[model samples]
Target: MKFFCATFAMVVTSATQAEVFTYECDTPPLSVWEVAGEWCSPLESLKNGLLIHQVDLCPGWPPPGGQFVFYTRSLADFDGAATFFVQWELQTNGDSSEFVGVCPASLSLGSFGPVFYQIVIARDTAKFHRDDGLPNIYISIAPDVPHTYRLELFGADLYTWYIDGMVVASGVPEGAYPSFYPAMNFGTRAWRLPNTTRWNYIRYGTIPLDAAGDYDSDGSVDEFDLSFFVECLLGEGVPSGPGCGFADFDADGDTDCDDWVAFQAHWTGPPAVPPIPPPCAVVGDTNCDGAVNVLDINAFVMALSDPSAYAIQFPNCPMSTADANGDGAIDILDINAFVALLQ
Candidate 1:
């Protein structure tokens, strides 16, 4: 019962943040995926979603090795907090350590440091590995049946794992993996046994576990978040641009009425008045002494020629003020306008 309550809490938390990426596996995932060994192409299926049949194991020790591995070609990679959701099934479970699994680990063997988590069917049972085997938790999982798995990582030290909407683990200590790329594999490189796995879908992203509608990230849902919420309300369509995430309360790719409903639930009246920040420095006034003069020339040149140096020299000045032409960028194009401003 405690586990069920934890599971519900996790599900609710996850539903509040939008998924950054998803692979349905209904068609070729070539745009996002790279595969090794004899992994068959994804095929469309009505009941199964998409079926990826892992062919017989590889023959030798080098190169492709024994396992059939499919991993993303590239990843933006989440920082601080992340959530991974996958619906899949192992069609065959072998007697040996032959297994099918998904994890946030590099393809290479020697990469060190903690991995966020791993979910696998190794010896005819499902196992979850958190933060590089802090400990392994095993549970009974039947072969040839699809199950949804959710793993949520909070910062570097807390995580929760769920299987088919039930929490198997929660608040597990995490050692911080830094960043991760999702990977799915069938048969171990060590065991070399064959198995077929079907992946229905996979979705992952950075998610805020608290303050679901806090747009400015000031830690409360209040008046300041309303404008961002209104801007992100796209009804049934996908929300775009920055700050849309703040309004995606249902995490369904769209900021619709449902999201507005959720957003209202977190509303905490008007936000507290924040302390005044340093004023934005005038353009060409790189020294930020409240005047644009010849004395600003050296700093202006530094802002143009050596941005990093300028940043160190004028740590309090706004970088945007360096955009002398108001072109919204600090580049060689701004030099002419800055020189004219000096004259």
Candidate 2:
């Protein structure tokens, strides 16, 4: 079944001081998601302004994959942590009959009956299931915090999971299942007291996983990326396509100077060993001399006069560095701006 592209909503959380984009599901309603048992509360709003699904008694039906995210945290200090899952359902006589939960934390594949693939995440650990040949692999994380969980199904069979911003696990399911869904159940081994699983929101769409401002997917955000970003910004190169989403460094759904500020933070190096650079650094400092001066002014003039000639003369300098006004365009106005900076 074809899934509709995602629509995003910008959200600000005062407590965490973080900006988030929530993808709202836009698919035609199949049915109000099935509740597993009586103890489970159908999706509803609570006094705390969070949408919750009380998984105290039953396992709810899992929803299918599209690009989306769900912010979840356990509401009660139960004996065991609450569990959320996605499963593959096998077709029987042209209709789904058996369910195999992927990402199973406490359950073994096919132990409960169906031959299946699954990935299970619990409070402290994550588990993966593909087939009988490979042993289930587990990755551990600190539990019970309001961390962002993201899942993306791409290529032929590749599925990847991300917690916060790091990829924790990814693999292709061994046997092909016609469809997938998300499920929620309280506890790993047994049902616990009346507890809640709070959801800030469930976004449906491909999350932008590329390194912010690293438009070329290279290891670092540097001069080359800056050039590409400026090209897109000025509409001079490839029309700002979906691929340009990587430049949205602030995650505010737009590529602008604000994002440029965040992108500059990574200019020192790759994410692993990022050394913070000073603030108020000028974008037009093309000479690499730690200051914007007359030398940069000359460089900008040469580049503006004849880009091809300038490229051959100073092959090391990126033409984008001369955009002193941050307007994503290089022209005489930038020359004037640079002179003003020198003044």
Candidate 3:
């Protein structure tokens, strides 16, 4: 189904860092990548030790994901008026049929005149026509200087572009497309001298909100989030609670069985809840008062014998931390483990 970004805004923040994979090509590694078109030369290094692609025809390379961050650069000027293009593409089956969820959204940058540089976002429909509402921005930078570019896809819909650390444009395109792979191409409308484009690096990975089992947004996936997820599934609270959208692990807009299955795989722990108590704390200390006395034992017995009854008696505890053995199931095993902890 076609989905579009509901909001568009320029945001700048100095918060959180993403783990990225970096590729620096001091030498040509054409064999590791799929390079297409006859005019494309194998990757070569410039005098400055940066890797570049010098081509007289349209040359393309592809990179994959549904949501990710991509950073690349052009190390030199185009020999003629050729355009450098990067597109998010869907892979096709062996029969040349389009893969599911692939859309043809692309960013094009080039010099229209000696002093003018232009950038445009294009979304191609299934019928191979450009959507009329795409946005374009223009700016001027010195020739032969490296320029940085960044593209971010948030969730499954929002697209944001950046130039030199500043947001240049952002919007949602109309139409359905599968997860995308970055396809980088350099070509001109008319033949000209071979233009060389340097690629400094490309970094791509999952967006945090797109991470599985991170329902609580505490920057980590753990039992607290899982307990909250259970609450969400049971309809015990409002669905719009903070970070509740992370519970929709499948990004399908609803918390259901499918999300549960996805969450299980994404969970980083042993599927146990509340997290282990700290040293000097009792294993079954539901109230966290740091004692192993009668009250703690009573709460454990109640939870083990009758969960519903225990929940009614201690509504705030949730019994997640009560499982002393860290087993996923809460049963006699946990009861014994808790008792052994007291000794």
Against the true structure, whose lDDT is highest? Answer: 1
Q: Which pairs of residues have clashing backbones in candidate 3?
A: 63-182, 101-177, 101-178, 102-177, 102-178
Query: Candidate 1 — what's its lDDT?
Result: 0.51
Better of 1 and 2 by lDDT: 1
Query: Candidates sorted by lDDT, descending order?
Result: 1, 2, 3
Best by TM-score: 1
Q: 1-343, model 2: which lDDT tens digit per residue?
A: 1121233333332321222233223321112222222323333333333334333224553333111112222211111111112221110110011112221122222222222444454555555555668786666666565545544444336655665545777776453222232222321111322223443434332223554665434445655455445533422232343334666665555455565556666674433322212122346676535577778766677777878877666554566667777787878878777777777
10 residues in a row with least lDDT, candidate 1: 1-10
Query: Candidate 3, residues 73-179: lDDT per residue as tens digits?
Result: 33122122111122221211111111121211122322222121123211111112123354334344334445445554443355555554456565653421112
Could you tell me every candidate's TM-score relative to the true structure?
0.45, 0.35, 0.32
TM-score of 3: 0.32
Which stretches of model 1 miss by more than 4 angstroms?
A: 1-19, 36-48, 58-67, 81-96, 99-112, 122-124, 131-133, 177-192, 208-343
**1 versus 3: better TM-score goes to:** 1
The C-alpha lDDT values of all candidates are: 0.51, 0.42, 0.40
Q: How well is each residue in 1-343 modelled by candidate 1, as lDDT tens digits?
A: 0101110111112333433444553455454556554333322232334545443444544422345544543332333334433333233344324433332111221113455455665434667656454666777756556655656555456666666556678774545433444344322232344555555555445443332876534446655456446645656766432325666766677777677667767877664321111222467877777688889888877888889998777775767667899978888998899889889
